[model samples]
Target: MYRVWGFITNYSLLLILGAVIALIWANVDSHSYHTFVEFPIAEHFFIGEMHEGHRMLTLHYLVNDLLMALFFAIAAKEVWEAVILKQGSLRGKKAATPLVATAGGMLGPIAVYLVLAMILGSDTFDAVKNGWAVPTATDIAFSYLVGRVVFGAGHPAVRFLLLLAIADDAAGLVILAIFYPTGDLAVQWLLLSIAAAVAVFVLANWLPRKLDKGRELRPNSTWVRNTLGFWPYLIAGCISWYGFMRAGIHPALGLLPIVPTIPHADRAFGIFAEAEKHLTDLLNDIEHKLKTPVEVILFFFGLLNAGVEFNAIGDPTWLVLAGLIIGKPLGILLMGAFAAHVLRLGLPEGMRTSDLFVIGCVAAIGFTVSLFIAAVAFEPDAMLGDTPVQAAAKMGALFSFGAAIISIVMGKLFGVKKVEG
Candidate 1:
């Protein structure tokens, strides 16, 4: 429990603080808040949002586009380890039902969001249709915290929730990369990102180990590890980021290619396990080193992205909320039950079928990533009547905290028995 609270405090508390400040500031003085958010840090910068004829770096752009890459890289690292490691959580028969449920979690939101939009009339549907991916996000940190509260530390549903959230994140990344482009696609620039990944993997990682293969001392690999450390990868990451920016993909995902290139432990202790911090592999080392910086990045991310005015609440807002609150549980319940019973994959021991709905309620708290998706989903100028669609959609993401209460209530109503550690 202490570990879970600590993780939340370290990663989420600051973000909440930032969000509270932004909400207060935006409501009190929206004009000033907007000015501050768009304040230019640099004009005609080599890397930033294109303004007029040249790139200009704003505080919002700095936090959202540049620094946020670290946050996503951390996410990518967990996903990579979960998929690649020998004892990974996302492997074998144990993960089949949860993986299938993850698919439903995502698909359900899209179906609900789009269907509701269409019902609201074609104009509203066309205005907000692109934002379908916003509600599919399951903020891993907040959802995990809420899950523990509802299900207790010993519940199998808690682990199942974490698995679903992680898989949702992996899928969310793919959605962002494929469905949302920052600019006109320039396919050729992606070659630079690929080249950087391959070069770093070979020159910094593969070669050193290859040279020390037969040697007991492993002097060459040791030299690289001790002397050079993370520099090579950092340089490669910068190159990849540039490539992503030029290639019109979200730059925040640039570090993804580099994450797999880093040396990692052969076995993972799971994302929330305390044992993970003790791992000395380069991947873990980089993640630990990045913890503080990523926390700060997330703080600004929340502040910059979550400043929708209270009046901005409109159709898109209800649409996003409906998708998360209504769609998530039903989707998970039906799909998870099918996978467990129909497919014969089965739920984890001690977890009842009814618990799947409760887990879905917990997973519906899509605060962070949902906010990000909303920001990228619509143009700043895009509007539904007088309300900005992006701002309204972001408001829905913020309101997803309501799902925490819904999860707790559903947990009790469904007669879920808490299993304490």
Candidate 2:
């Protein structure tokens, strides 16, 4: 319980605070709130939103496009560690069911969102179609907190839920990169990102190790680690970010190409594991250093993104909610059961099939990433019957908190017994 509270305070509380403030401010005085969000810091800046004939750096752009990259980088680090480390949770047959379940989790929301949009009529479908990815997000920190409350720490379902959430994050990143381009695509610029990654990996990571291969002290590697520290990777990350921005990819994901270029620990203790704080590897060190800043970035992120006027609620809102509340649980149950029973990928010991539905319910709280996807999925100016489609979709994401109550109720109704570690 202490750990759960700690994690929430560290990662979630500030975000919630920011969101609450935004909601109140927007409702109280929408013009002032929006003005603050779009306040221009600089014009003709190297990295900013394109406006008129020049680039303009706005408060919103700074938080969303630049600082948010660090947040996504941290997420990429966890995903990388989960896939690459020797004791990775996502490795081997142990992850088969969860991985398959993850697919269902994403597919189900997409299916639900699109089908409902179609049913609403083609004009509505065309307007809201791009936001299909919004409901597929599972806010990992909140979901884990809710999961612990519902199933206790020791429940196999808790671990299963974590695995599914992590996998869902990985998939979400891929979707963001591929489907949510920020501007007109320019494939050639991606070469710069690739070059930056390879150059840094070789010069800073691989070369030092290669030089110190036969040395007992590993002098060269130690020198690079101590003397150079994170500078090379930082420089590479900036270049990669510029590359991604020029390539029309969302710059928030730009740091991804650089995360893997940095050295990491041989094993991971999983995301949110207390043991991870003790690891001194460069990757973990960087993550630790960025933790507080990322928290603040998330605060600003929530502040800028979650400010939907209550009256903005419309078709997109209900569609996103339906996708999460209805689609997520059914998808997880059906696909999870199919994987466990039909595909011969067995559920973790002590995890009942019924637990999958509850995990799905918990996973339905897609606040953070869902808000981000909503922001990008539609133009801010896009409207549906006087309601901003983005705001309506964001309201749905915000309302996903309702899933927490639904999960607890379902847990009780399903006879899910708590298991304390």
lDDT of each: 0.90, 0.91
lDDT of 2 by residue, 203-239 (tens): 9999999999989999999999999999999999999
Q: Please report the candidate that would top lDDT against the real structure.
A: 2
Error of 2 at 265 (Å): 0.9
lDDT by residue for model 1 (195-226), tens: 99999999989998999999999999889999
Find the number of clashing residue pairs for candidate 2. Answer: 0
* Candidate 1 weakest lDDT stretch, 10 residues: 379-388
The residue pairs that clash in candidate 2, if any, are: none
Instruction: Tell me each candidate's TM-score.
Output: 0.97, 0.97
What is the alpha-carbon lDDT of model 2 when measured against the actual structure?
A: 0.91
Question: Backbone clash tally for model 1?
Answer: 0
